[model samples]
Target: MAELLKAGAVFFVGFLALYLLIVLVVWLGQERMIFQGHVLPQHYAFSFKADFEEYSIPAADGAILNALLFRSDSSSRGVVLYLHGNRGNLSRWGHMHRPFTQRGYDVLLIDYRGYGKSTGKPTESGLYQDGEAALQWLLQYYEARKIIIYGRSLGSGVAAYLAARNPHQLLILETPYDALTNVIQHQALLPLPGCIFRHHFPTYRYLPAAEGPIYILAGSHDRLIPLYLSKRLQPLIGTPENFKVIQGAGHRNLAAFQAYHFELDRLLLP
Candidate 1:
């Protein structure tokens, strides 16, 4: 029995050490794991709009990010600064913004540093800087109060953080996680403490001080970002009307549903 106990203790210690090492590796390689972007071809075209005015905004750290400003058919209500998901570039994500443009709201979509034509390695803090830079560039043509920020998936954290810091009028988050740490833990068989995460896009942390009205649109059938996680945000915002969960909608295909736009219209028009 004494020998068996000693062997069991040794096995437990070894497993703990191996687990810590795995966590360390995940921490170091997280940036690459988080951001997936293709190399920008020299002839990369912006087919999102023919008259789409492209600009190169400089971050505080001197990284140059490429952004697209989609003008409305008529004079706009405001510009929607769209922070998109982790995959693809602004050009791909721009297809998702036609609802805003069709409503006479100009949409500004940005490629995070290292995505599409943008330069500089992407970090959590650097993403926040990129968002601010895009907003400031928009302010050159529109007032800060006129801008409404929208974020989807990975961009939700960036959008929430920006809305909290800036004077935007409205904030719309689609399938946003409570935090990146929460995302990783929820997907795991056994959840871990959030302290191990290095790339902390804590959207919940910023929601408390968000300056504008907050609207959350989440999918009831979202497999990637569970509905319960999105539901957790309701307590923080303290308003049932601010949160909406669409039936039979998944993470990537929520926009395809008519109910999605129905909810959006209620929020935008109301």
Candidate 2:
């Protein structure tokens, strides 16, 4: 019986060691999992069919952030400062400007640090600073009332952060979460300490401080950021009319849904 007890103690120690190792690995690799930015060459030329002018905004940290401003063909209603997700550069996301530009709203989409032509590494605070720089640049041409802040997936946190501090015409979030920790915890293989996460983009914490109407759209079938996670944000800034759910839609395919376009038309059209 003493031998069996000793063996059990050894097993427990081994298991604990393995668990700690896994936690360490996850902690170290959190940035890669969170910010999957695609880097572009400095000399890379963007060729889009849309009427767009490129921009090079200087960040506070001496990083040069690259952006694309797609102008509306018709009379401009306002401008949309679109903060994209964690994947790919402006080349992959630039096509999305059509939805806004077609509706007479010029779209200004900027890449975060180390994404596309931008310089330096990306952090939660760094992303916020990049967003602030973009907002200031947009304000140079348009008033705060004519600016709409649109955030998608990973960008939702930054959008909420900016909206909380600055004045904007509207705040639109797609596939947002209450916080970045909520997303990691929901998808984690083993329960992780919040400290393991380097970036905690607490959209819930920022939403209450936001001025004006906030609209949150989520796909019912979004496995990446499940509807429940997005639903957690509704109570922060949602009315029955503000929080929208697109049925049978997944995380990446909301634009394919007519219901999504209907909502956009209602919100964007004059």
Candidate 3:
């Protein structure tokens, strides 16, 4: 009996070690799995009434990022610097073009590194650097204009980091996670201790430092990011009125919610 117990203990230790190794690999390579390219379908394309241009902005690490700039025909009330989710490129945000453009807001949608035509591997810091570079490009090129920063999902962390660094005209985060670590813990169902999770995109940590107005939108049924996470972060926001929860919507379907459309219109419209 004693011998059998000792063998069991050894086997358990070995299994734990192997499990941890697998987790580390998954954590490091999560971006590759999460951010597969989504090619733009020609059927969904729309004609641009105003002058639209594509740009290749250089990141801080010297990576060239692909971006689309949509300018309104008339004087725009403000410009929206859009950081999209992990799955697709700027073209995927084509659905958002008419709504924002019709409101007379210029939108700059960018494809993060490793997504779409941008070069370089996707990492937590790499995305942040890409956002900063995009913001700098907008600031330098579109001077004397109001700028609103908008992000969804993973892009929310990048937007929050930028909001902390610079005073944006406004900050809008949709279906954002509290932190990357929390997201991994919830999704992976890992039993490992918190000390081992290293990728920290702590949007909560930077929220307080944001000097401008912030609008946080979350879905009640968001499977990817739990509603409770957004609920927990809501009180931590600089202003409580900025937070909103979309009813009966999940992470991907929030855009279809009429309340979401109304809130977006209220926030982004002149």
Best by TM-score: 2
lDDT of 1 by residue, 1-270 (tens): 999999999999998887777677666767777888765864687785436888889988999989888888987888899999999887678686688887778988999988999998888998999999998888898898889999999999999999888888789999999888777766654555566677889899899888868999999999888998888888776466889888999999988899899987876653
Model 1 steric clash pairs: none
State the lDDT of candidate 3 residue by residue for 43-122, as single tens digits: 33434455578788999898788888887666887788888887877666645656677778888988888776778877
Clashes (N, CA, C under 3 Å) per candidate: 0, 0, 0
Could you give the C-alpha RMSD of every candidate to the true structure, in order shown? 2.4, 1.9, 3.9
Q: Per-prediction TM-score, please?
A: 0.90, 0.94, 0.84
Top lDDT model = 2
Give the 10-residue window scoring lowest on summed lDDT in candidate 1.
186-195
Q: How would you encode candidate 2's per-residue C-alpha lDDT over 108-139 as one tens digit per residue?
A: 99999989999999999999999999999999
Q: Against the unseen true structure, what C-alpha lDDT does each candidate score?
A: 0.85, 0.93, 0.80
Better of 1 and 2 by TM-score: 2
Global Cα lDDT for candidate 1: 0.85
